[model samples]
Target: MPKQAMENLTESMFYVLMALQRGDACGAEITAYAAQVSGGAVRLGPATLYTLLARFEKEGFLTDAGTVGCKRYYRLTAAGKAAYEGERARLQRCLDDAARAEITAPASLTKGDARDETARQGNRLPSGSLPVL
Candidate 1:
């Protein structure tokens, strides 16, 4: 399969893509679910989320199915699904690599080793010294 362009996606865009992977959802529900899933780490404020959603919609990553009030419901297009899965896999590998680098580093390395590695990768360590996403 052709690889998807997931590396260009922002964190919120990535989370929103993953949120739509399982099923369709309106804006509010998507934000709520993403926030819950990320344990409030990935905040999808209205302006940011909807704006990205609009871009994703335009880019054929998501499709508008219907709306309730001002809220628009969306489902992932085939491309969107593929992108989401690809991005999820990429994120998983990043997390795995970070964890492995931290664990397997020499004993002389301290907590700063793990924290610095996480920072170098532009990722924050998840709560309890774990990766969140």
Candidate 2:
């Protein structure tokens, strides 16, 4: 099967989209905002930032808002918002799975405990229904 576009965004792509969420910004401004938001963990080089801007524009995730002097500004399009939301939900699911695993570690689970836990989560089977072995 063909790989999906934007199914998995790189850290740089995520931060870049996040930065644009604030408002339209030039390349330098976007890079600075990314660094600030990530607590200096994500610093986009000029080349990387430019390349991302170009790709995003081509993919309809961003639009060239305008230009001032030599600086070009960009704004997020609806496609960009969708991509950002999709990434956010994907990350949240990862966190939820990790937390669920931590709470249900094999070492802490016993035979009957699984049934009790399922009941607590409102997933109780019909009365007298056999649990899958």
Candidate 3:
């Protein structure tokens, strides 16, 4: 059976592709880079990272660059770079549209948004505290 082309990437997939932009990296290095770049917001566990690596390689977006010891490295192909850039642009457009809508939106729409949440209180939560609605 033929594999279908990916039309879009999920958040983790997008970050993994973005991580490769720094240079060729092995699985551990890519996971570290993604975490560092995302300020710990994205954590790629071993299983998830390996799955993505295998899938991207199959999709022609990545290639085996080298292997050192047990760790295999991956490099982005031209198609991978294009995929990253395309996803970035798509994300940017989504943000742009949201910004435009926010500006034109009626006041009620943004009342539950982050800005309001912040203003509701210099009311910051403590470490590990769940936010109060």
The best candidate by lDDT is: 2
Against the true structure, what is each candidate's TM-score?
A: 0.69, 0.78, 0.76
- Tens digits of per-residue lDDT, candidate 3, 1-133, equal 6545666788889989988998899988889988998999999999999999899999999999999999899999999999999989989999999999988997655568765777588866676976543
lDDT values for all models: 0.84, 0.90, 0.88
Candidate 2 structure lDDT: 0.90
Error of 3 at 118 (Å): 26
Model 2 per-residue lDDT at 77: 99
Model 3 stretches astray by more than 4 angstroms = 1-5, 107-133
Off by over 4 Å in 1: 1-6, 106-133
Best by TM-score: 2
Two-way lDDT contest, 1 vs 2, winner: 2
RMSD of 1: 10.6
Error of 1 at 123 (Å): 32
lDDT of 1: 0.84
